[model samples]
Target: MNILITGATSGIGKELALQLTSKGHKVGLMGRRTERLQELKDEIGDIAFIRTLDVTNHEKAEEVYNSLIDEMGGMDVMILNAGIGRIQMLPPWEAESKLIEVNALAFAHGCHFAMDYFRNRESGHIVGMSSMAALLAHHRAAAYTASKHFISNYMKGYRQKAKRMNADITITEIRPGYVWTEMTERAKGMFWVAPVEKAVSQMVTGIEKRKNYVYVTKRWQLLAWVAKLVPEWVWDRL
Candidate 1:
């Protein structure tokens, strides 16, 4: 299968690209770091194509998708894995809105683009990387949590719309608890940190099974459900 992954420079996106390419799948890697992209291309040999792109740039992102589709002949899957997470302890009003732009708006655009392509071909998969944080409000990372919630909700709506239209496109939302990626490397003492390889392996399995919603670790699923049962006061205490 031919796959296009955004934010392919680091963390889960990079790990997914490596895993997929090693499995002999054609991969189109999209990221802003040309150096890392070139390194990946060299390491992965000819099956991997690198596109230096910033997902937040709507025009560039659209162009990259079209170019990749043309270059690869066609894409079987599009993974909207590009995201940013930062601890924002300030008032919500003072937080930078770029988190929303990157995590939510960029993902929405990718979903729309992928849906258009898949709708035309009448077959394809759209995978969005949300976080378990979407299940609850986080005090220090309000924007990040909100963005993830938006992603999860957006994918849910897309799934419903696709079902109603009888579209062949399958939308999968992956909610990971905590993975040992560069983004979370600084988060020490977090026992929930699953190795990147482990997380990606589970994610790949879920994708192959066409699971609509998946938690990378099974424990995350239980935690998400438990979080929902917690009262606002109890949640705030965490």
Candidate 2:
């Protein structure tokens, strides 16, 4: 299958690219880092196409998506994996705006573009990258959590619309907990971090199976469910 993945320069995105390309799937890799994109293209051989585009740039994102769709002869799946997380120590108003811009607005635009394309074709899959933080509010990462919650809920709504229309489209929301990526390396308890390969593997399998929602790690799914059942007062004490 042909797949287009954003934020393919590093972490789960990079691992997914490598794994998918090795399995003989055509991959269109999108990222802000041209150097890393070129390196991945080199490593993956001719089946990999690299696009140096930022998800935050709406016009560039649309152009790149069109070009990738044309290059791949139409995409079977689009993975919305580009995201930024900021642990703000200041007041919520200060950092909240940028967080919404990157994690929420950019993601929403990507989803809109991809969905339009897929709806026209009447067949496609969308995999959205949300976080387990969406299920529980974090003190320093309020904006990040809020943005993820937005995406998660948005995908859920989209799923309902797709079902009603009988569109041959699948939308998967991935909620991952702590991952061992550069962004989360400075986080405490590195030992508990989920391996990038394992997470990507599970994601690929879930996407292939057309699962509606998945937590990259089994433990995270359990935690999210448990968090939902916990009393508000008890959760506040954590």
Candidate 3:
């Protein structure tokens, strides 16, 4: 399959590229870091197409997506993996706004584009990188959590739309717990942190199965169930 992965420069995106390419799939890589993109292209060779552009740049991103699809002859999947956490402390509004733009807005754009393409062709797979935070909120990362919630709800709507359109479009939302990537290496209070490879391997399997919602590493489902079962008053204390 021909797949395009955003944020392919590092972490899960990079690992996905390596694994998928090793499986003989053509991958189109996009990220803001030119050097990192080049490195991936070099390592993945001819089957990898690299493009440097922020996912927030919607126009350019669409163009690059199409260009890569052309290069690969066709596109079968779009992985909206580009995302950022509240990794640094900034002014409240600034941090929240940035997270909204990259994680929520940009992700919505990718979904919109992929749905359009797939609807035309009547088949495609869209993999969105959501988080367990979609079910729980953090006071320190309110916007980040809220954004993921939006992704979950929004993707649900799109799923209905796919059914309405009668298109063979699969929208898979990945709600992952802590995974030991650069993103979570320094995170405090993390438990059951799956190795990046193991986490992404499950992700690939879930994506291949075209599951609507995937809780990475499987054990995360216990936490997800707990989150749903816990009383709101108890969570208010946390």
**Ranked candidates, highest lDDT first:** 3, 1, 2
Candidate 3 residue lDDT tens string, 1-238: 9999999999999999999998899999999999999999999999999889898989998898888889888889999999998847787788789889999999999999999999999999989999999998878779999999989988999998998886899999999999998888778999888999999999999988999999998999999989999988887899
The true-structure Cα RMSD of candidate 1 reads 2.0
User: What C-alpha lDDT does candidate 2 achieve relative to the native structure?
Assistant: 0.87
On lDDT, who's better, 2 or 3? 3
Tell how far residue 26 is off in model 2, in angstroms.
0.6
> Which pairs, if any, clash in model 3?
none
Q: Compared to the true structure, candidate 2 yields what TM-score?
A: 0.94
Estimated TM-score for each candidate = 0.94, 0.94, 0.97
120: Cα error in model 2, Å: 0.4
Model 1 residue 83 distance off true place after TM-score fit, in angstroms: 0.5
Residue 14's C-alpha lDDT in candidate 3? 99
RMSD of 2: 1.9
- Name the regions of candidate 2 deviating beyond 4 angstroms: 87-94, 189-191
lDDT of each: 0.88, 0.87, 0.91
